[model samples]
Target: MDQFDWKQLLNPEFYILLELGGIKIGLYVVLFIVFAETGLLAGFFLPGDSLLFLCGIYSEALMKEFSTGSDFLNVTFLAASISVMGILGNMLGYWFGSKSGTYLYKREDSFFFKKKYLFQSKDFFEKYGGKAVVFARFLPIFRTFAPVIAGIVAMDKKKFMFYNILGSILWSYVMIFAGHYLHKLFLSQFNIDLTHYIEFIVIGIVLVTTIPVLMKLLKKKA
Candidate 1:
């Protein structure tokens, strides 16, 4: 791999992975991004799914940054850590929505805020009700706003938390483990290194996750 390029900092893939400025805090950065992406409205553009997948690919290395655990333990720790961040993020988002009420709807759109995304989340929440908390976990923008929407409508707290915990674990573990095991499988069986193809992998994950969101938005427009 080439030396970490400053220019790559502008790229979401590198940014989310904390490959900038020779920073070794990949784990902390990943956790914070997970939290922001799930909890903060401005974090809608952050690369949540791709970040999780990349973390999987780099699981062992990331673990070594903090521990000498076995491979399985490393991946589990990474996934569990990320899951906790995601859960907390959703809780914060819910709290924000519950306290803010209709303020978000009336708030003007800035560079980081888009009213359409909020409305889309609203539609998704209305259509799926409580299930949106779970379903939105896989979708990009929806995942960021679903909890907030639930909070806005004052959805039952216990029910919201049940779905929140369920969704966070499912989403985090699936993405992270898929990356970890797939990377191991390909390297061991096919002699292929996924790190070299990280860009393509990131792009593929983004498209797969975002296409549904785009289609939903388009369908609504039509």
Candidate 2:
């Protein structure tokens, strides 16, 4: 069940470059990664809170070197941008789930095709109703599936969009700002290595992203 442990790949330097290298470079990568994490069912475990928080703090750091923007504007842009990414990503994921997922994915099917987790997501949404889309956005595993299941169950598109945008923006701001403030606390309390923290964040994202797969493999072995 052991993976390549790609989580090891992320390091503090990665974040420094990710946020600092250039807007052109860091911007697209962050957008794409965020999309994949939200859209792909396999990506549920990716660190939503931690990732955004880390990016937010690092983005704050970058403001010193580059005219990123006013502090308020920076957070606003990041939150709005993430909102769009999460929503758009869900649209695509839902499309795949609705158009082909029903036939292509069956719960009683083979292990490779089984969407057991999707069923759990369905229950969560049913219990919470439309708000589950927004509510689950904060939870780790459910955050990923709520949208895709919303699509599968034919939750109203307009409703989904409304909640999705609201949730994404709120989630982004909370995490990013939390990261920024936490960084300040660390600095004020004692000298801390920012680079090391960034690297650890990236690695954490990678591990969280891969955890589900590892869990499934472990089940197979059992």
Candidate 3:
């Protein structure tokens, strides 16, 4: 393995993920990130979509760290585990938002907290109603704050949870499975290994996921 590169930390692939080494640690880090990105305000900057996609591509390695099961079992376990974390993370966000109330809106921007993102999430939630929880799961910054917005708006707990569970499962499974199966398909058909070109893959994923959010924000501003 190459010496740990501090510069790689800037890349979402290496951003507080696996830098410490060990597949087991990597799995735990992935769970933590899933939780933090949804649960904590400071987690808004974390890579949610791209990371989940990468998890799919590297599903085998991550799964082996936890279980020696068959391929189906491994992928199932990985997706299920991530889904649970995502649900829990959103729950925490909802809880925090409920407790904090309007204080979050009044809270000035800081390194970790961005007022604009919060407002953006509020607008998304208003537009989508309760469904924002589900739709926001696929979007980056919105996913981080949607749950909080749900709570802030005092959305019904049962409604919030229904969307939360649905969104988390769908998001986690889709991203992970997409990466894993695509990697398998390419390797089997063309003998191409995606892991070798992870940088390009990460950039592509980021752009695909984020560009829409940027355009939406810009359009709203205009």
Candidate 4:
């Protein structure tokens, strides 16, 4: 049998921290990534779904590597940390939106300021109201921009917080846990080595998640 190429097996795009041998650094990196992706405007281009899933897979590997007996506790901590990071990011985004609402309103469409996107976000917010915060969590680009739009429209802070926390908890738990458990499942059932294929799986997951959004755009264009 041939030896597995650990270096070549890992996904270059997804294994940023692991490739660097920075498990400890990965935690902080994941936290910061979550914060930026959720809070900052530039985060619109960051990997959200696939990254969270990969983080879950990485968490599982880290637990095994450290020989941590506290599997449940570790999972809880990972989920909680990501959930908090996402929530805090949304809060920062809301603050920026509130402060910049007028500024953004007067600005014309350009590379960064696409009036259509703002309109789409506004329409989504208006259509869903507070629930948009929760629903947006499942979306890709919309998830990043939803909170900003909420603040731009001056959504009730208390209401936004309620939905924000709930959405963050649900989103973080679903993606991370799914990744973690799915890794366990495949390894156990198929006797497959996850390290060799996890990258491809993550890519497939991203494509799947993006399908609905792409379809929506296609329909609009049609």
Candidate 5:
């Protein structure tokens, strides 16, 4: 790749790890970010949706760059890897909730800590039950916290696992492959690179998915 291509690839909008040197650090960075976002309480602010989708689009670039006949970055590998990362992230989140999340309500709110987010997540989990695992996957913030709430409520492990696996597969495939195909289609049909505008597209997606929850919260606050 040329210097311009390298600059674009390293752009924070395209790849999450701007300081990590190159896309060769793909799977590790993707998995670690997903796991932290879904598992840790402090990770609620991470850009889960954008990262996954952008990673998918970048995976195509990586595949082309590293194409050694059949040794390219396989699409199935990318999808499955992301799905597994999501599943494990939720599992870890649930574990953390089961261990200490219930007592968190007692802790006084402080810097970087907001009880309202937890309460909102709890309300959603209670309203949706096991289905939240699947539904929250599409919604930002909720996707990371729903599993934590589930564990705090001591929900059935089997049920959580089932939906966790299902949701992970569905969300990962949809977001990742959507970016992949959108990039491909735009390049082929319109000769326009969707990648240039991917950050904006991701913002739109985040807003569309989370607006309902935001409105509900606003109404409740009123």
Candidate 6:
């Protein structure tokens, strides 16, 4: 048996603080997560919608300034911007996977990167078609690597890019806006900074949103 350090596991509260910090830092983390998750296997677990939603919810609380989305870097615009980041990340992932999968893997491994989960993601991409690009954006444990795998398998580049852009924007914006509007609808009671809850809650929703897959994983592990 191996001893797993629990502290190594992501602390949900860290994400909460990131959310409560406001737009600039919040958006920075969101963009980083989106880019890294799709850009490289090593970053698959980085926070996404949970943080983004929190950003939307708590945009007023942060201590920085920026201008982008609706009425001053609103969630809509934040989502849209990060969506582009995700797409670009996927593009880089694809190129890396297609042209230098092994070399890239080896290089990353030299730095202690683990990609055990990405194998499953690759299989999912194989089983599904280009739809994986769009739909995978909403699936945990699969969304991060599906596009990269598409490149490994030599999926059509132009077509993959189209789906990639559409899905990245749709997924990123959907989660951020959902948090924004949902909180706006109930600010009196449920009001909290969206980012504070999003990096974890939104991710939980995305994961739970595809419960069947999770159940299968649980069953397999069992």
- Candidates, ranked, TM-score: 3, 1, 5, 4, 6, 2
- Candidate 2 per-residue lDDT, tens place, 1-222, comes to 335456533332343345333353555556665687657654444455566767767775444444456877776676677668877877776676666657645546443233666665677789889898887777666676777777778878888888888887777777777776677777778767554567576566556645654674577569
| Two-way TM-score contest, 2 vs 6, winner | 6
Clash total of candidate 4: 0
Kindly report which residue stretches of model 4 are placed more than 4 angstroms away from their true locations once superposed: 1-23, 61-68, 105-115
Better of 1 and 2 by TM-score: 1
Report the alpha-carbon TM-score of model 6 versus the true structure: 0.74
| Every model: Cα RMSD to truth | 2.5, 6.2, 2.1, 4.9, 4.4, 5.9
TM-score of each: 0.92, 0.71, 0.92, 0.83, 0.84, 0.74
- Give the per-residue lDDT of model 6 (tens digit) for 161-208: 999999988887777676667777766677664444534675576566
| lDDT string, candidate 3, 1-222, tens digits | 678776764465674246353334678888988998888765667778888888888777676656756887788889999999999999999999999958988988898889989988888899999889999999888998999998888999999999999999999999988988999999999999998998898889889988989999889989
Highest TM-score scorer: 3
C-alpha RMSD (angstroms) for model 3: 2.1
Candidate 4 residue lDDT tens string, 1-222: 446465542342343354354344566666777787768664555677777887777775544544357766777778888899999999998998898977766778764446566666677788889998998887777787889898988989999999999999998899888877887898899987565776587678778877877887787689
* Superposition error at 7 for model 3 (Å): 4.1
Give the per-residue lDDT of model 1 (tens digit) for 29-118: 778888988677646777778888888888876777766458888888889998899899999999999999599999998877888889
C-alpha lDDT of all candidate models, in order: 0.85, 0.65, 0.85, 0.76, 0.76, 0.66
Give model 4's TM-score versus the native structure.
0.83
Give candidate 6's root-mean-square deviation (CA, Å).
5.9
Better of 3 and 4 by lDDT: 3
